[model samples]
Target chain A: MNTDDLIDFLATRVEAVDPGRQDRLLTLAMAGSLCLAALACIFALGVRPDLLRAMGTFDFVLKVGFLAAMVAIAAHGLRRAARAGRASGKLLRLALLPLALVWFAAVMQIVATPATSGMATMFNDWFVCVLAIPLLSVIPLVVLTLVLRETAPTDLHYCGALLGLVAGGIGALAYASFCVNDAPVYVGIWYAAGLAIVTGFGWLTGPRFLKW
Target chain B: MSREPDLEALMRASQSGDAEAHRALLQHVSVRLRSYFRNRLRRSGAGTDDAEDLVQDTLLVLHTKRHTYDGSSPVLAWTYGIARYKLIDHLRLNARALRNVQIDEMDDLADVDRYEAVDTSRELHRALDTLPRHFRLPIEYVKIEGLSIAEAAARIGMTDAAVKIGIHRGMKKLAALLSEARP
Candidate 1:
């Protein structure tokens, strides 16, 4: 029970650290969970009736593009956060870039479009967007939580918020095709709000669930 | 042997399952942590026993989190980061426990002279003896002997996680037994 015996106990049971194992597991989990989220969205929510037409629209493309970027950045941040001593400020700033970009685009669109149309665009599917994004994020959030528990995350709240961001981004990406509202302002505000809800939830639960 | 141990190389070898390297790395870290924790705990007006406990706890965490270490980073920095986190967490938990003890002391203030320390110790041992082996061992090693969870697990030949669970359940059972015997 002394430190020597404890060292022997630990050393003898040494499991080789597989190189890139963390990244592989995280990537696989995110991909698989994203697929599941997409399927859930397709089956549960059903695609928009003008699926082909919506795909051709610039707004639809922009919405999907922004969500995809957020997912990629947040996923990268999550990867860094999962490891010990790798949490960095650069990653945080990088993660915020997509939000900044989307918000800027939203502002530009709001300025160019008429006031009445701007209000209509924002409210078109605001309710559905907010409700569905967080609902769909549950799968990825659960998956990420399970994966993260195996890895060491020193900053529980930060890692948790990143988890929620990645999960919600995946959810938004999955729900993008099904949504009828493709306006930049709507996507910017409602998507961010939905993601914020999940992120806040993650931050709150991080200390509780992510405790090693 | 080189004049200075290359921690990075040792850690790299350790990560690849070299037992000697792993042992050496742990011993090196343990020595450093003992002093580090001792100084920090002293600064905070805590005991050397707490320092040893923290050393073992930090070592266990370091072992479990070894896989998360990026090979390129300085191994000592990563180890110390985990140690600092463990120390801070321990302090926070201790603070909360101290607060609870204060509240309990307040409640027991009127009857402070009624319960003797010797009687309480005897009652606690009696309660512990009545519990089953799995539960009893954890409490005995961790609480009575003041061993860290890793040490208790090692002595009991159980996994650390199992030892933790055992202590938790044992404490609950002990509380129930004590409450039942009180009246």
Candidate 2:
């Protein structure tokens, strides 16, 4: 057949696709991510100590409320990411905002707590939070990375890298909110370290496993 | 509830969690997609079953990943990209199947038609190769790939008018080459 005929044939094949299945598949995929987010929230809340010492009753409520909101947003993002695999541009872009918020809150808590000369105190206060970064941040980062992998164009690799970096930055911000101390230097160092690690993870996994 | 909304607007609303918008968007695009697959099957000598299967697969991908589409870009570009990937995958699978079978056992008539189609296609490709890269791509994208003028224009960063003009000139040259080979 001539090229025109070939194209006409292809166009018809493309036009025949059922949009209903697309919606159903998207909803199912997103459901997996939402389930993950729910489990993560439960683990995070359970691990966190009582709010009685860190902040008063009102302050504690506010912090818990904020954390809940972050989780909700992340859940929404997870759902959206899964449903569209990579089709919806608006939801994909908007997802970054909540993911960033979650990271910001985490970082604040890390920086606000006073540094201690005692090895045990320092380890318990800062190290634990730092350790949890990879586990918690990686989940959402990996999810977004998967979505980006499936949806992103070949020419958008740079944008994808930049997206990883953004994910890292927001993660840093979430870390900051929980920190009691106000040391910008420590925040810069530890947060940057965490960001670099997660960004690297995204870069590595995004290309290989994320390809749709 | 009311008269149907525009597909683009429905997509935007659906992103914001409007159920009606989501339903409307799906209904509007489904018929167009069916037509697309049906036409492809007819031209390629494939059956309706294959076209229907592909249509279902493409739509499933589209619905699940609606969030990946940025409202800023044209909807067709985003959808077309998904469709292209699916088609390529289908072609690859078919090629693998053909490779597994014995080519020597194939009938001559089937072979002749395949050869003629490939031979003519090669001639057209070689003629296309003679054009400058800039002119060649626009023509291939618009004429050969069946992309809308707007999509071809956006992909190559050319204005719609420029893409149209380039395609016109390229087609004229291709036609001249094809006619020359007729004698």
Candidate 3:
């Protein structure tokens, strides 16, 4: 079409633009997907039998909190990625704080405990943790990808990667309740590994699917 | 030449559903994009006709993504961002296609008559036909037939909001289709 014709096409019958529409849509979609992931995790894996008892522990709270923080950061980054020219490298830098904090806690815990005990806790259910987290992430990742296509994202790679992180974070959080390994070292290793897999999935598929 | 502030004001007014303001904003934007694309295309050794297509593609993206403007940045900056993305995308697609040229075809590439003029509207219509009916009808009615959203909604038997959404989504899908069709 001619440029003028295209202009006329777009300018006709314009509606009042809702500035918050994308933000609202993304937040609702993410919330709904996270809820779906949580439910799926609960039903499929079953929550740890001593769930209430686990909630009282320091390591459990830290583990859950770490995942929650990652999700929040990724969501923020995703919001930035949705807008044209708004993506910033600073968000990635900010995310390093949480990474450093979790690793610091893990290191301290490792140093405090005997090497044998720390290593044993770190490997508990490692296989199940990695596999199950990605499985749980499937719903949120797919949902977020679909929702993301409705908005314009220039940095498809960043946007896709953030979606993966958000999905993975939710998956990890859901898995936290069911996980028996509460050691900071275990969380620092196994949980990070699972999240990285999802994030890698996002990074690889981002340029293909997020393009629009 | 339209000043940035004037364009920004037009953008703000356009956001409030003022069709005239939107038209005015887009006219200015089209002028800017034409020159922008022309310069970039010249630099990249691409045809000026491709610039026209890129201008239209970027405009479509801007139209569909207007709500993401947020007004925190200059309107031109936002426009330039989308324009840059379209330019890069076009160049990248061209490069990929160029990579597939056989050594035998390389000899024929020097022929002046080898290229055909791009028929944008025909291609656009072909692209539109590929969209789902729900997404296509609202665009055909409101954009092509020049019907208002309410009128289109009534005829399509969808709610007005649905019609609006359909048009928005249809435009996005159309833009994607156009992008894939880029020469």
Candidate 4:
């Protein structure tokens, strides 16, 4: 086909862009996601009674720090992922920085508290931690996908991975309040696993749902 | 006259379901992809129809993905990215399929005539279209179909010398046609 004729034929099928579509859609998506996750956390599992005490410890800061960093960095990537063929090359590095730091802290934490009586109990509820992170991420994942659908992303795998990071981070953050255990190693090991599972899910779904 | 050839403006109008704007956008995108698809297809020695097929498929992709175009990025980069990805997917699928033929059944599939007439055929390949049937058939059997000159001569019922000359003249004409196509 002649290029001109082909273009004319295709252009006739296009629909107009609505004013302020991207901004309006994203704003609602984030707000709705947070509200939904927070609600689920409150009704399903109340915040740990000792959350204030947990907040005062350095471990709380470190644990929350890792998740918060993931959320902040991944959110930045979400915007760029909106463009086709564009992906944040920094996402992996940004995600790893916090995780590595926490892992280091976990090592120090174990060395400092070795052979403690409560050490055996630390691994208790480990399954629950793994289950809760991705389970809790479902709503945010759905909500983020709604916004993602509105943007044109070319690299579906990278963009989907970034979305997974963002949704997983939010889930981990919400779960932090209910979680009383602040062992850096546990957070490093189990929490990291949970996030990985979420990220893997994102990668699996990227090609199917993020085609646009 | 049309106000101006504004792709972004056309995209904006397209979001509102305007067929005129959609047509303009498709034309603009197709003009760009013509070169994009041609470059890759030519590299693989694929026929011109392959390039047109890619363009049409891209147009459909753009239509389906129309809602995702946010207009914040350059339209060329956006469409070009999509075209590139489509090319990658096209190559990936073709590569796998071609691999089995090339490795496992190269002898049997060697020189298969892709130019054979099909009932549904509607367009001519630019390079082959200009040659007369006699010249075209000889060249195709010898070159594209991988038949030796004697083999082609036996098949076409012509002397090997005449078959060789037909192929040579046909090739010269095909070259002229291809050269003309470039500029």
Candidate 5:
């Protein structure tokens, strides 16, 4: 058909779009998926018996608190950057702040630990956690990417990494419930490593999966 | 492109499933697409009707993908992004068709490529002439010639870092000048 004629026809045929509705639907899907994932972990892996005791401690609070903060900041940034033409450096920095604090706390713990102290305690579950966090993040990470299919991301790779951070952050929080080791070093090393791996995975997949 | 228009409000209304708002938004985008495609086709030695066909395809894609457009994004960018993908798809289909037709003509095209490259290189040189020597040298060596940073550094008699900075600034200025020169 001719251009003008087609334009006239399209004028009548065009359907109203509801991006806000889609955004709300994405939220519902992600939240429901995370809940299901957490439940699965609890039922299959069993919550750590000392979880209640650990929750009451200051150190434990700080650890989970850092991850919680990551979820908050990353989630906010992900939502913003998911939009077109949104190159929000401020949001990226805001998301990194929580991670930086966690790293800082970990460094301080390393410094304070006696050089003579056995290395076994410090390295406990370090390798295992590096593997575990990414695996745990798979469900939520997939959910996040699926949710993002409805939105436009200008910097696809960065957006994927950001959402990966969100999933990893939330996944770590879920995993924490079953973990007994509350050391700053463990959280710093394992949690950070796990999220890094996921972020890397997102970077590789972002350009391919999130290109649309 | 029409920042003065209340695009956000219009977009929000469309997001609420207001048919009139949706129609208005689509019509607005359709107008922009017409001009965009016409300009692109003119530059690419294609017919204006190709623009219409592509624009129609873009709208269809947009209709299917409307829910993906987050309400907060600039409609222009989002719309253009989808248009770009549609353009790519169209080009790919055309390319495949042309490849079949040109099965025996590929060899002759090599000569055309060389001639075009020479003309392009001369034009590029003219553009580079406007840049300062410090910026131009590094860009020519590292960017155009595809020289390593160390090679560029040695040729320009500058540190690797200085060469990198010069190439960066030179490219940015060249891009600005080139874009300004174009419609």
Candidate 6:
């Protein structure tokens, strides 16, 4: 068929679609993603803690694990969002806020407890920083809030926001374990710097590489 | 024509239960399916009402039989098969309706003349193409995909106000472009 004829036929058919049915399908697809994200979280936290700890300390391990989980969940959410005919670019952009927040909080913790020369001081500082990452985790939470505010009608955004929080929390824990050092300022600056680096990577590569 | 096909990556993502890949596949295929149904309706001489029902039925079938869509084949072809079936069903239904009425009992052509208005599909697409990329993408999601403003906003990383404004302005620009194209 000619392009014009094709366009007319599609527009008519699309208009005929039942709004309720579309909504239901979208919801079902998103639910599937949520299930996947949950499984990923369990795998990262429960099954692979030691591997994550090897990256840093126990606390750092947990934070990294959390971030890894968030990435997994966001990936899952992106799939569901696509099936429902949601925009992928916007979803990823919205996802960035939470990732940014988790990274920021982790940096803050490292800043508060600078590692010292002695093994005891290093372990103590590392533990304290790890503890603080989860407690002061707010960037992901804030990012989620912004997503919610922007996409008020769709429950999918909320799903994304919650997934972000979980992912960010785990990520922070993981970073704490592997990257502990002596300077709190270095941790804070570099951690924030690290997140900024990730954000840049996500922005530059996310659009091209992450399209599902 | 400009969009790249990352079939291997898409398949891997789908297999691994990547939600974004699945969603992208649906959106990409749905556009082609709409085109398929639209063409059939025009050829069949069906009015807008018949066309709309046909489209909805096609989508329902697609969703139900999504598992049958083997990743090995082109997604568009798979979607077209389902759409073709729905169109044939519509034609059959119409034939039955016509048979029930005698030739002399048929409604006056003049009375239904308004329903026979020229299809604006080409004009719409042309107008859409003329839109700036920024405006066009949102319109594609909101108007074509039938997503709500909030949903579109979330997907594009813009606030609700921005999406709404973009759609409004886009519609205005589309109207102008279409009007200019009209004889």
The alpha-carbon RMSD over the true interface for every model, in angstroms, is: 7.3, 12.4, 1.7, 12.1, 15.6, 12.8
Q: Provide DockQ values for all models, in the order shown.
A: 0.27, 0.05, 0.61, 0.20, 0.15, 0.03
> What's the CA RMSD of model 6 in angstroms?
19.1
Q: Which residue pairs come into collision in candidate 3?
A: none
Error of 6 at B161 (Å): 52
lDDT of 2 by residue, B86-156 (tens): 55555554564466455653545654444444356435577688787667878788666768778988999
Tens-digit per-residue lDDT, A1-212, candidate 5? 34443334333323345566655765676677668667767876789898888889866887899888887787777877676556556775676677677778767776887755634566776776676677778888878778787566667677877878877877777788777777776777678788778777877787778855
lDDT of 3 by residue, B132-183 (tens): 9999999899888889888999999999989988987788778776766665
On lDDT, the leading prediction is 3
Candidate rank order under TM-score: 3, 1, 5, 4, 2, 6
Question: What is the per-residue lDDT of model 4 for residues A32-108, given as tens digits with 9 covering 90 to 100?
Answer: 78678867987798989998887999989999988888787887787777766553477667779888999898778
The candidate, 3 or 6, that scores higher on lDDT is 3
lDDT agreement of model 4 with the native: 0.72
RMSD of each: 7.7, 17.8, 3.9, 16.4, 19.9, 19.1
Native A-B interface contacts kept, per candidate:
0.51, 0.03, 0.74, 0.52, 0.39, 0.00
Estimate, for each residue in B63-166, the C-alpha lDDT of model 1 and write its tens digit.
76677777756877777777777777777756754675677865655334323422553345665787899999987887666577799899999999888778
Model 3's lDDT to the true fold? 0.82
Poorest lDDT segment (10 consecutive residues) of candidate 6 chain B = B110-119
Error of 3 at B118 (Å): 5.1
What overall lDDT goes with each candidate model? 0.77, 0.50, 0.82, 0.72, 0.68, 0.46
lDDT of 5: 0.68
Off by over 4 Å in 2: A13-46, A52-125, A159-192, B1-71, B74-183
User: Higher-lDDT candidate among 5 and 6?
Assistant: 5
Considering only N, C-alpha and C atoms within 3 Å, which residue pairs clash in candidate 1?
none
User: Candidate 6 docking: what grade?
Assistant: incorrect
Which of candidates 2 and 3 reaches a greater TM-score? 3
TM-score of 4: 0.65
After superposition, candidate 4 runs with Cα above 4 Å error: A1-6, A9-20, A111-121, B1-28, B60-73, B91-183
Candidate 5 pairs with clashing backbones: A150-B68
